[model samples]
Target: MSRDDRQARRGYHHGNLKQALVDATLELVVERGPQGFTMAEAARKAGVSAGAPYRHFKGREEIIEEAARQGFEMFADLMEHAYASAPPSALARFEATGRAYLAFARKFPGHYITMFESGLPIAQNSDLKRTTDRAFAVLTRAAEELIARMPKDKRPPASMVSNHIWAMSHGVVELFSRGQPGTKTPFAPEDLLESGIGIYLRGLGLIERDD
Candidate 1:
């Protein structure tokens, strides 16, 4: 077989080549930052010829987008379950959704990295955008419920409230969950997130501060 024929053979090497490419992309995103690796390297990692990846993905961007898309889907599911399964209180369910974010990131570092750090513009991919919106909507819904208890004059915009918590959770994940994890600290990431949210809510008078 000519070299091109061998490359073609690699394209047909598996029944699930697309998933293999996605898996390889995830691995590479963690090992080397998303921009650090090339599609050829991903194909090599997946044990396929350089040309084989094109059969499954247009380029590295598509592979990362797929990883991010899957990540958002899983994230939305976890957040939905958390929001649904918590104690029967808006605060409880809202807090549960916050916890779920941490759990998902800790459990799926590769997906986490790909989804948030890959720098791929998810909004361009309709499916990826929808999944991401789903994940975010969980937080937005929780924020809406939590803020509804306050007077309309005092209530923060739901999007701002949700984005605030989202930023806080992301900060905790990056600093404690992913970055500077080995550094000595008195608090775990969960504690930090919980306390951070508590403080923010208290400042907004959304929650009564303990005397």
Candidate 2:
């Protein structure tokens, strides 16, 4: 190959090497907190020379931010899948989406924590912001559908109903992630979430309210 071609290939390799390094560092973040993570360790895990990460990332924080971006991208994908996989009914889809979100947080606590942290530079990424909104948009559509299906006599405004359901589900999942309805309690996480959503539906009069 020509010298210029070889140089371009080397640059591309360096870019990919840095991405792999950040990916490895995120895995470590799951096991070890961010404060305890290091660039050299990430390089070792990525199978690159110890100094290679410096070619792309300035420091440990830079790698963490990139990893956080990747995490949000995955989060958006999970939300999309949950919404797409639910049954025909809007309410059924809403519940499924809520459960899926909680499952994601429980399964990937590290990424969940990073993605939601306001101080993280990853939150500023345009793609992360866009993906985050797309995920919420899925929830919004489910809310609109549910509101549409409500009995003509009692249906709430779509905007109001959407906001209510979204808030209700997000609150339950966020609290559960913080360890609410602890294992010491009789109810499983799923049980608590199901019960909470039922109560919310009853309040909205979407389900028959027992007097």
Candidate 3:
């Protein structure tokens, strides 16, 4: 066994050490963006020795990457719950998912930024790719349901619609919801998303009467 493993075994709270390290990493990400600290710093923050993080993570990159993975998993759950709680209308459900996306970004700024802005190569990280795909699948499923309710001739391709909505929602969050520097819009992020999506759907002849 490695020396780090030996030390971990000797520790009183070995079982919870991984979670403690993750928690500490998140605190650091919040204080100083995702790239702000080193693995040793995260270990120190977690109250472990300099070499302790290696017991759970390969290095600093892996630590943040794992955090991003967890973020995506939580994000998927939020989207699923939002869709499930919405009214019967497909449009309503789709809107709810969009709102959930924005809400997640607002509530979990550290996770949101790391998930999107961390610059991690998703293709190289199987776990990250899988979790991200699951989160995206929620949006795609919602789009498919919405398109199904439309007239056969009016329905756009589900994939195209899903991508469009995802792009718009992401743009809105990146520009307005996160309080980032961008065009100063008087409308709230949710309001902006609602209005923009409403217009886009109308333009596509997807919905006529706004119920």
10 residues in a row with least lDDT, candidate 1: 3-12
* lDDT for each candidate structure: 0.87, 0.71, 0.83
lDDT of 2: 0.71
User: For model 2, how does the per-residue alpha-carbon lDDT over 1-75 read when each residue is reduced to its tens digit?
Assistant: 754445445545656776777667767776777776677787766766567678888988777777677777787
How many residue pairs clash (N, CA or C atoms closer than 3 angstroms) in each of the candidate models, in the order given? Answer: 0, 0, 0
lDDT by residue (tens digit), candidate 3, 109-171: 878877887899988999999998888888888889988877888788888887888888899
Residue lDDT tens for model 1, 17-78: 78888998888888888899998888777767788888868888889888898899999999
Best by lDDT: 1
Clashing pairs in 3: none
Residue-level lDDT for 89 in candidate 1? 94
What TM-score does each of the candidates earn? 0.91, 0.72, 0.85
> Who is ahead in lDDT, 1 or 3?
1
